[model samples]
Target: MNTDSTRRWLALGALAVAMLTIGLDMTVLTVALPTLAVDLNANNGALQWFSTSYTLALAAVMLPAGALGDRYGRKKILLAALVLFGVASLACAFAATAGQLIAARVVLGVAAAAMMPLSLAVLPVLFASPVERARATNIWITSTALGLPLGPILGGWLIDNFWWGSVFLINVPMVVLGAVAVAGLVPESRNPDLRPLDLPGTVLSVVGMLGVTYGFIRLGDEGWGNGLGWGALIAGAIVLMLFLGWQRRTAFPLIDLGLFASRGFRWGAVFAVLITFGLFGLFFTVPQYYQAVLGTDALGSGLRLLPMIGGLLVGSRLGDRLLPKLGARLMVAAGLVALALGLGLGALTSIGTEYWFTAVWIGLVGAGMGLGLPVSMAVAMDDLEVARAGMGSALLQALRQAAGTIAVALLGTVLATVYRSELGDLNVDPINDSVNSGVAVAKSTGEAGMLEHVQSAFVSGMGAMLWVCAAISAVAVALALWVLPRRSAAVGADEAVPAVFADVDAPESTHVG
Candidate 1:
């Protein structure tokens, strides 16, 4: 291989390592939340804020960060964001109060927002060949994805042996390594045209996302009847509509709406969002089932998730092999079918259901995610021009992030509402609040039948939520078959270009730092 070819692969390795940290951050906190509540003397409200703050900041800053990377330099912005992410991790580690931790989490979110898009933006700059790009994209995606299951396992072990701060502190070394590697390996790249920032559009987008994200979070916590949640949801929708209108009129828009004109980009993005909805729903429900119902500690709960990871690895390998022959439409449809079948089986879970049964179904769900997610992402990205890579990727990430937040909220509501209804007029307000609270109350009071009631109620609720997820996956399968293109644009383009010089200079090139 040529020297330039080696350099591009090495650069992808650095970016993948950096992306691992962002993925770790996404789910690591889940295992740490119960511990944080005890250590920080936090209430349920504060516990929710810890996560909500991060989601809000991440959703708000992503679009603007993408525009900045396109206007300035992607590599420079990525490096800066990495440094800030490390700093925020340190701050979160030593935070003295709930409010301080929440504040630190918001800063972490902003840094992550910048990192996610710019890392993806560099892929087209490094590899021009469709085959090489697909391979690179898979590696990039797997690095980010592996961290999701790893988060619970790693966080659980750290919390068991070390203090809660270790979870946050763990990010420091990874961040430093990723930053150094990125600086040495990745070339600087940005749009040569240097479009002006859309300040009005930026404000509207941020406000709209904040409102909509926070609204769902509040509704999930307080129930669907919450007045504040309804108000925020309505207001955010109106603001987002205005933002869309502004984008149509603005000379230099934050996102290029024209990109969605490509059927590949539009359907790929839609399928990706649908998959995220189911994926996050699994993450949301399963950990609690492990901890509360199965009577396991955090470490045990995390260890139990290994089957899903195993399934994911198998699925990804199959997707990489099959995508070329079967094409995106068929491969993605097969993936969604696997996903739905797994969720459908998971809906059969009961209080007495065996661990092996749970493992089989969750593994299938993971496999489905592995197969569908990368192909969908690759299809969407295949349509982007090199100049718009940063903004376009940002738009896709923003939508996926929004979908994840909604999944957690909507699924949580389904679980909570069903759980409460099953318990029926329990005089204990704490028992009515959640299964965790009910479990705590039953144990403290040594109330007969209360523990049984809570466990059964929770399992029933979980089954209902899984059913909902299965239905959604079924819908995605239909859409994939109906809407997705028969083949990727990359495969078609690859027919004309030789593989060896795919990374060589094209008409457009990124300015090397």
Candidate 2:
């Protein structure tokens, strides 16, 4: 390979590292939450805030961060985000109160917002060849996937061996390494043709997304009828409608809604949401099942999730290879079918279900996800002109984050409602609130039957949630067939052209610093 080719691949490795760290951060906090509650003397509300703050902050900043990267330089924004993430990680490690930790988490979220979009946007610039880009995309997807499983294991280990704060501290060295590698390897790239920033559109988009996302999260935490949740949800919806109207009329819109004109881009974004929607539902329900029903510790629960991760890895490899021959429509449709089947099987889970049975179905879910999500992402990215890569990717990511938040909230509500109904006037508010609390109450009362009943109730709720997931996957299958391209010829013809990515067709900037 030529020297330039080698450098690009090396740059990809650095970028992948950034993706891994960011992905790990997303899920790692879950395993640490219970521990943080005890250590920080945090109330239940504070515990929830620790997670929600990060998510809300991340959602709020995605579009603006992407625009900034496009206007200034992606590599520069990414490097700065890394430093900020590292510093925030340190701040989290030393935080003395629940409020302080939540604040630190918000900062971490902002840093991640900057990193996430630009990281994906940089890929087309580095791997101009479609074949190479697909391979790189698989690695990129895998790196991020690795973190989801690894976070629980890593966080569980640290919490077991040291203070809860160790979990946040662990990110410090990794971020430092990623920052240095990115600085040395990744090339700075941006859109020269970008219009001046649209301040009004920016405010509307940020507030609109933040409000909608915050409402969903609040719905999960406080319930659907919560005044704050309903208020924010309505306000967000109205503002978002206004944002859309503004985008159409603005001189320099934050996002060019015209990108959605491409059927592939629109459908690809839909597929992205559907894939994560299923996965997030599992992520929300499974660990509690392990710890509350199966009587496992956090470490054991993390280990149990390994099969799902393993299946995802295998499926991703298959999807990467199959996508070229099968095309977007058939491959993605088949994937949604597999995903639905997996979730359908999972929906049958009962308290008496065997671990092997659970593993098999969950693994299928993982495989479907592996097969589906990355290819959908590639489909979306394929439509992007390099000049618009950051904005396009940001829109996709924002949609995905919003989808996940909504899916989890919806599923959480299902679980909560069913669990409460199944508990049936136990008159113990504590027992009615959560499975863990139910378990604790059972143990405190020395009622093995009560524990049994609680486990059965929780499993029933989980089954209901899984059925919801199956329904979603079924819908995704229909959408895939309806919206995705039916023939490879539609996209393959332009796969290798340098001009397919704008920067590759343009002269390199001699002034790149």
Candidate 3:
């Protein structure tokens, strides 16, 4: 209705575009992995690095990125990040070897680390009204959700028609447009009372996260008995314990440990992490099932996942309305119930099951994620002072990423271990490598039995993995019910917005320095 209102919504669009790039990057590379393996002459190890490098780099810098935005300016950092992301995307597109691509991905991850938190951090400053913030957040969630399915569909089409590099190159025009829009629309905001950077705390947090993340990743790659993996896990756990202790003692800590005192922040964070744990784990397994067992091409598989995106949009809309009425507790609890039911259905899927059965479960899980994730995320941010918005958002996202990484690692290990054990004494070297490798081998040798065996083994592993996901969702439901706050308490913690034309006012700039 008003000019200022229009600008803020437009600003949110720019932020959403930036967020969309990050989400697209997450899944876009996945479909190209096989192409990369051949074109780059990559071994299994190097192939894993292409993905892991990005994730590790992103995790390592998140804590610091948030502080940097708070100390300087959120908009300034976001603009710079957009430029860096575009440059990194170009590098990724032109990479000639696995090593070069991995290096490029690391840069892309660091740029994304800065954008992700600051994008959400600006929300508190943008839409001050609680009702408006909820609706804005739903749109923000949808933009990110839209990118997930787009990656597979778009990446599949690019890989099918063009080269593998085109997937990364496509990000260039979008990022450039996003940077221009953000520069013109988004306001500069930072914490005037923010303290100097805590150098020691920063180092500790980085070390702790990197060590833990690497250990889990190694566990997936090399298995449980690897000495290096065990050593990394032990060392990471010890370092993280020390980091927690330091956080408690530090004068100007990297993150305020006191924020955990609020039940809303604490449990909301846990539920958020659980949501990613299931979602990423499912994504990790389901695509391969489509390609390997169902004998579908990349494009077909990507198109098949469209139903989940539809469910996510519908669920997000429901969350925006239900969160205000049901409170965080009941709404998230219901979502987790839906998630568990969906996972349970997925666990029952066999090798020859129809696509519609899978779609029903996938849609349910997506809907659950749509409902649960935003409510929990908003609850985590609701009580945060505007000054700590960056750090709070960073902490929430960092934790979720960590959870997703661990979920993928653990669930992948489960699938691999069960598949291998079930296909014991196969004596088929190619078959033991992976489902894709086994299928290729089977077709080359013209052995129908081999394909059947591989399919059966993989289905067993998938079923077991989905059951584990269902169990986790069940636990999340109980935690949501037990720990989430009532409507009155959650509303009491909701931050208030000053008038639209207050002293700190404008269409272009809103918050004070």
Tell me the tens digit of each residue's lDDT in model 3 across 1-513.
222888899888887777777778878877776566557766334555666677666766766776788889988998998999999999999999888998999999889878776776678788888789877766666576566778889988898889999999988988888898888777778978777788888787767766766676566556678788778777888888898899899888777788788766788778878877777767767777787888876777778777777777677677666667888788788878888998999989888899999999999988887777767776777766766554565666667666765666667677766777778766356566566766777788898988888888888888898999999899888888887886524432222111100000111111223
lDDT by candidate, in order shown? 0.77, 0.73, 0.74
Model 2 pairs in collision:
none
Candidate 2 local lDDT, 1-513, one digit each (tens): 233877887778877777777777777777665456456765334545666567666766767777788789988998999999999999999999988998999999889878777777777777778789777766666566567778888877887788878888888887887888788877778878675878888788778866776676566556567999889888998998999999999887877799898777788888878888787778767877887777777777778888887877677677666777888788778878888999999889888788898899989988887777666766777776766555566667667766765666567767766776687756266676567767777999998999989888889888998998899889889888887776444344223221111100111111111
What is the TM-score of each predicted model, taking all chains together?
Answer: 0.85, 0.84, 0.85
TM-score, candidate number 1: 0.85
Candidate 2 vs 3: which has more TM-score? 3
By summed lDDT, which 10 consecutive residues of candidate 3 come out lowest? 498-507
Model 2 clashes, total count: 0
Candidate 3, which segments miss by more than 4 Å at Cα?
A: 1-16, 34-52, 73-76, 96-99, 119-142, 180-190, 320-326, 383-390, 427-430, 486-513
Q: Whole-model lDDT, candidate 2?
A: 0.73
Across residues 339-413, which tens digit of lDDT does each residue of candidate 1 receive? Answer: 999999999998789999999999999888777876787677777777655455567767777677667666777
Q: Note the clash tally of each candidate.
A: 0, 0, 0
